[model samples]
Every structure is written in C-alpha cells, then in structure tokens.
Target: MSIENDLTEFISRDVVPEGGVTETELLISSGKVDSLGLLQILGFIEQQYGVTLLTSGSPKDFESVQTLASAIRKARGESA
Candidate 1:
C-alpha cells in the first residue's frame, strides 16, 4: 500500500475508528483527530518511513492523508 493508503487505514482503525478518513478529508480541523492521535500519526510516519519528521507543528502537515503523505515525502527528502 502507498503512504496515503497506509495512513487512511491506520487512522481508520486507530484514530477515527468510527468514520474512516479520505485522502482529502479534513482531519485535525474537523476535530476527528486530536493531539494524541496526531502523536500516533507522527510516530507511525517515523517508524514506517524511517524518517523522524521535523515539522513546524502546522495543522496543515496533518490535514489529510494527502497532506500527511506529502509531508512524509518532504521529510524523506523527496518532492512533496
């Protein structure tokens, strides 16, 4: 599975178990994801991608599956 797919599945099971996330869905702003959930996501990105992402603590970084994937790619020195 791709980064977006992985995040979507993980968020669905662990974060927002009630309503699954879409690639373009609002996560943090929508209140579907909280601080703890954000930490879980960051940890997942670090462990799964082998990249300890240094972020600006921007909600945009954790906005959606698409944005998160882009952030992860950027952290890995890949084009976002």
Candidate 2:
C-alpha cells in the first residue's frame, strides 16, 4: 500500500483509539492526538518504515496523514 494509505489505516486503527473518524487532512493537533497518541504514531512509523522520525521543530509539523506520508517517504529515501 502507499504510504498515505498505510498511515491513514494506522491512524484509523490506532491513534484515534477504539473507534473514531480519521480524516487524512484533519489537523492532528486539534485534539485528535494527545502526547501519548503522538508516541503511538511515532512508534508505528518506526516499526512500519524501520526509521526514526524526529519531530524537530513543531508538533504542527506532523499534523496530518499527508505530512506523515511525506516523512515516511523521506525516511525511505524516496522523493517527498
């Protein structure tokens, strides 16, 4: 599956807890993800892509599925 699709599924299955809507463009910082939730996402990324993703600047930097997919692509050395 594409990174975007994989991330969307991960968010739907994991980040949002038992059952919640997961919109790809939804802002993660808008209470959809808390601190613990961010850790879950990072952990998922690490396991799925076998790469560490550093959230260097801001939480907003990783606020959407599209952004997460971009990070995955960059880690895999694919053009972002």
Candidate 3:
C-alpha cells in the first residue's frame, strides 16, 4: 500500500476509535493518541517502512498524520 493508505489505516486503528481520522486533527492534544500510541506508531513505521524515528525533544513531530508521513518519508530516505 501507499504511505497515505498505510497512514490512514494506522490512524483508524491506533488513533481514532469512535470517529474517523481527519488529516487536520490534533492527535495528541485531542486525546486521540497518547505517548504510548506514538511509540507504537513509531514501531509500526520502523517495521513496515524501514523507518527509524529518533526524537530529541519534539513531541510535535508525531502530532498529526501529515507530520508522521513526513517523518516516515524522511527516515526512509525519501522526500516528503
């Protein structure tokens, strides 16, 4: 599957429980995703796309589907 499809599925399964995942949604602050969810997402990206997420201090990196897709593309040596 494409990145967008993979991301959509990930969000649906891991982030959005009741409603559908909006691309503009605030994943963390909206309480749709927590720290553990972020970690699980990181792991999923690593295992599925050969991406390694190494965050220094920015929790905002994992805050949205767009951001996560960008990070995953970067980690895979691809341009977002």
Candidate 4:
C-alpha cells in the first residue's frame, strides 16, 4: 500500500474510534489523536518509511495524513 493509504488505515484503526480522519483534518486539535498516539504514529512512520523522525520537529509534522506523507517524503530526501 502507499504511504498515505497505510497511514489512513492506521489512523482509522488506531486514532479515531467512531468517525474517521480526512486528509486535511486537524488530528491533534480534533480530540481524535493524542500525544501517545503521536508516538505510535512516529513509530509507524519510521517503520513504514524506513526513516527516523526528528524529535526536535514540531507537532505539526504529525498533524494529518497529508502532512505526515509530506514529512515522510522529506525524510526520505524526496521533494516535499
């Protein structure tokens, strides 16, 4: 599966309990995702994309599927 697809799946199964996440939704602010969830997401990104996420970066990096995909791309040295 693509990174976005995988991430969407993860968010659906792990983050949101009832509804679901949209690409542009504010995951952190929506009460759908929390700090522990962010750690899981970072781990998922690292394992799935084979890159270490910078701990020094902003929380915005894990804000949504779209933004996370861009962060993964940038981490892989691809143009974001």
Candidate 5:
C-alpha cells in the first residue's frame, strides 16, 4: 500500500479510539492525538517501515500524515 494509505490505516486502527474519526485532518489541532499517541505512532512507523524517527523540537512536528510520510521517506533515504 501507499504510504498515505498505510498512515491512514494506522491512525484509524491504532490511534483513534472507539467512536473516533481519523482522516488527513489536523490531528494535533483537533486534539485527536495526545503525547502518548504521538509516541505510539512514531514507534509504529519505525516498526512498520524499518526506519528510525528522531524527534526534533516538538513531537507535534510528526503529527500530520504528510509530516510522518516525509519522515519515513527521509529515514529510508528515499526522495520525499
């Protein structure tokens, strides 16, 4: 699957709680994810894509699908 799809599925299945909604929406702005969820998502990305995610500044930097995908591509040494 594409990286976006993988990210969407991960957010839908793992991050969103019951009766919650997940999309390419502003996850941080919407408060859909907390600090713990951010960490979990980072770990999930690392485990799934076989890449390490290093945090710089705030964890919110990795909050959105686009940001996470870019990070993954960077970790894989692929063009983003």
Candidate 6:
C-alpha cells in the first residue's frame, strides 16, 4: 500500500475506528482524535516509515492523508 493508503487505514483502524475516515477527510479538526490518538499516529509513522515525526507543531497542520503523505515524503527526501 502507498503512504496515503497506509495512513488512511491506520488512522481509520487505530485512530478513529468508528465511522472511519477517507484520504481527504478532516482529521484533527474533526474532534475524533485526542492527544493519545495523536501519539498513536506518531508511533505508526515512525514504525511504518522508519521516520520520527512530531515535536513542536500545530495539530491543525495534520489535515488529512494527503497532507501527512506529503510530510512523510518530504522527510524521506523524496520528491512529491
């Protein structure tokens, strides 16, 4: 699976688990994810992509699957 798809699935299963989410769905602002959910997302990122994410940033910037995929690509030094 691609990064976007992977993230969508992980977020849906591990993050939301209720109504679930689409790739372009609202993430942070949807109010479904709390601080603990954010931590789970970060952990999934590190474990799946071998990249450490998050430090001091706005959660609103998380956005959705497309946004997160771009961040992961950028972190890996891969072109969009």
Query: Against the hidden reference, what TM-scores do the models get?
Result: 0.87, 0.78, 0.77, 0.83, 0.77, 0.88
- Tens-place lDDT digits, model 1, residues 53-75: 55543557877899889988887
- Per-residue CA lDDT of model 5 for 1-80, tens digit only, reads 88878887888788886544444577777788887887788788778888767543245546678777776786678987
Q: On a 0 to 100 scale, what is the lDDT of residue 36 in model 4?
A: 87
Give each model's whole-structure lDDT.
0.84, 0.72, 0.73, 0.79, 0.73, 0.82
The digit string of per-residue lDDT tens for model 6 on 1-80 reads: 79999998998898899988898887878887788998899899889988776863345448887888877887788985
Model 1 lowest lDDT segment of ten = 51-60
RMSD of each: 1.6, 2.4, 2.2, 1.6, 2.5, 1.7
Would you list the clashing residue pairs of candidate 1? Answer: none
Candidates in descending lDDT order: 1, 6, 4, 3, 5, 2
Q: In every candidate, how many clashes are there?
A: 0, 0, 0, 0, 0, 0
| Deviation (Å) of 58 in candidate 2 | 5.9
List candidate 2 segments past 4 Å from native. 18-23, 55-60
lDDT of 5: 0.73
Candidate 3: regions farther than 4 A off: 55-57
lDDT of candidate 2 over 1-80, digit per residue (tens): 88777877887787775565354556455677777877887888888888677644245448788877776777678998
Candidate 3 lDDT tens digits, 1-80: 77767877887877566675766677888888777776777788778877777653256667777777877777667997
- Candidate 4: clashing residue pairs, number: 0
- The 10 consecutive residues of candidate 3 with the worst lDDT sum are 52-61
